[model samples]
Target: MKCYLVPCVAGFIAFNENLDIVDYELFPRRSIISKLLEFEKGLTAEEEKIIKRLLKDYGKISIESVHRWKYGKFKGVILESPNIGGEYLRENLREILKEIGFIKDGEFQEIIYEIHMGMTIKRLEESFREQDKLIIQAVSTLDDLDESIGKFVERIREWYSIYFPELESVKDHEHYVKLITEHPRREDIIKLKKLPRESMGAELEEEDIEIIREFARAIRSLQLLRKSIEGYIESKMGYLAPNLRDVAGTTLGAKLIAHAGSMKKLALLPSSTIQVMGAEKALFRHLRRGSKPPKHGLIYQHPLVRGSNWRVRGKIARVLASKISLAVRKDVFTGEYDPNIKEDLYKRVSIIREKPKKKGKKRR
Candidate 1:
């Protein structure tokens, strides 16, 4: 209650038990909470302590008092009170209050309201941070899964090479994986008919095939997990950053948000910062060594940038970064999804994707 009254005409009524006026001027400066308290004039040190203690547990803040103050509930009290002190305070302080611009805007009252009732925002932000960590962790797992799947498949080829070198030469990575999973034994693989009519691969015993099958089974499981994480990322990113997802696609969009640490932090960034989404190492190197800064970063992974020729990668990245900046702001502030933004951005990207023209040599 004192927090709101600190700015009202009644704020002047503060007194200690001895009835001595406690000047609002006593509030300390150079501290975070004191700065928030700056809306009030000259709050005393004791009052600042109470506010700090109350704020330590957001639930303790007075909601009713904040609601009343947020609507300028005391404005009528100061104006309508017939009391001489109220009239004097109102007349003498009106100019100062107007000068402070509190009368011109309800922004200060809104801040007070938020302080009293903004606990949910803290919880939601915590939830957002947890989700980002989980997404990053899942993405890392998927990356590892990819590497493991590759290595396991390569081993599968080597293991079967002596028995069915012909199969290794004929089948591509995917088909070989499928054949191993479905027909681990040489007898089974050659039963239907190999790709080539001539059996170039030596026949293997059923036991040799069983050993290979165990490894194939594990790799197949890893692939399924990778697919699951990809889908999970897509669904979660859509929920967390819908506009970013629409503009950047789920995986890259989540990567961008995760890289930024939080949506609010990302939204606060300038378009230039968004431009260099993931080139921290290169950027730091350039800054330290006075080397030429790279034009693009991980944003090059965006389809528009990646598909474009190197000559135009920088241009496409710039445009994409600018659009992503706008999209991120939209998602963070309004949570509104506008398809036109995505469509227009891709249209512009298409034009940028065109190969740069070669310059002809000039004759003197």
Candidate 2:
């Protein structure tokens, strides 16, 4: 008698070629969904017990691919080919299962609904556990804050230049804002910063100084917000992807994750893809127009890549991308920090830096 073992949401069922139930094992009512999920992943202990019990009576049995993991030790166990007896069992097993009181009129539908809900909740919980989503948002907010601060600083410079044009010499936006906010009068600024008292710009009314000071205060607030977002990104990257953070700094690592959509997606990408992730437009232009391919993308922001000689940046970018790939994989899979990744990366970069520059032919 050829017997087949079929797994159901309720439990495991063994039957003969004629669809006669030879033996069965039903899980507890409360654990039906949990057991079903475990069974989907692999053969569970409950399944092994039932299979062992049936093996005592049945000389030969066929099992599905999911159960093949444990098939090596079991004698007389055959792996059922695709769409063979298993399909027939699946088609007719519902009726047989209902007849045997394993499930009632509406119980099967309920089990399926519960399983769907359970899996959906599981996926949602996993997503929540991963901080990539938070990192993406933080990076985006940081970018927006940067743009806002830039525009506001430009406006402040223009407005303040009307009163104290000498202040325009201060290139740092934060210092410029501070100078105006603390001392709204041109005389006060010149005396405090030790500048000449010559006046090329018009003297503003107290009202105008107040207005510029308020504008500068708003820009200062934005700068503070930008710093806070940067700190948030650093904390999140340290916790979620310490290896990536170590390989790439906090801001660059967060940008990579944001551009890749998520850490899981980034971890799966090839080194080449990761290297050009933020330069999709340039890559597409190269493919479409036969232009020279880009040597690097967002990773160009990294000191190791950016500070290198232009001629060798491509090689360094390639090496950096490869190390980043390994780092991200370890971050996602093992969650253990390996210090060698950073050390090896620096070693390779130094070797590339030491290579002699190629000599060019003299012009005739």
Best by lDDT: 2
Top TM-score: which candidate number?
A: 2
Per-residue CA lDDT of model 2 for 1-364, tens digit only, reads 5678877666877778776777778878777767766776777887788778877877788876655666778888888764245676677755767876877764554455455446433432444555688788778767876787788788888888888888888898899998888888889889988888896899778878886787676677667657866887888888989999999989999999989989999999999998887888999999999999988999999999899889889999999999999999999999999999999999999999998888999999
Question: How many angstroms is residue 224 displaced in model 1 relative to the true structure, after the best TM-score fit?
Answer: 0.7
What lDDT, from 0 to 1, does candidate 2 have?
0.81
RMSD of each: 24.0, 21.7
Q: CA lDDT of 228 in candidate 2?
A: 67
Compute the lDDT of residue 68 as modeled in candidate 1: 34
Residue by residue across 1-364, what tens digits does model 1's lDDT show? 2221233421223223232223333223223243334433344445445445434433222212222343342222122223333343344454444454434443333333344223222322334335666666556656666787788888888888877776766556767777788877666667655555555667777777776776676666556656777887787777767888888888777777778877778889887888887888888989999887877877878888888777888888888888888888898889888788799897898776654687999999
Q: Enumerate residue pairs that collide in model 2.
A: none
User: What overall lDDT goes with each candidate model?
Assistant: 0.61, 0.81
How badly does each model clash, as a count of residue pairs?
A: 4, 0
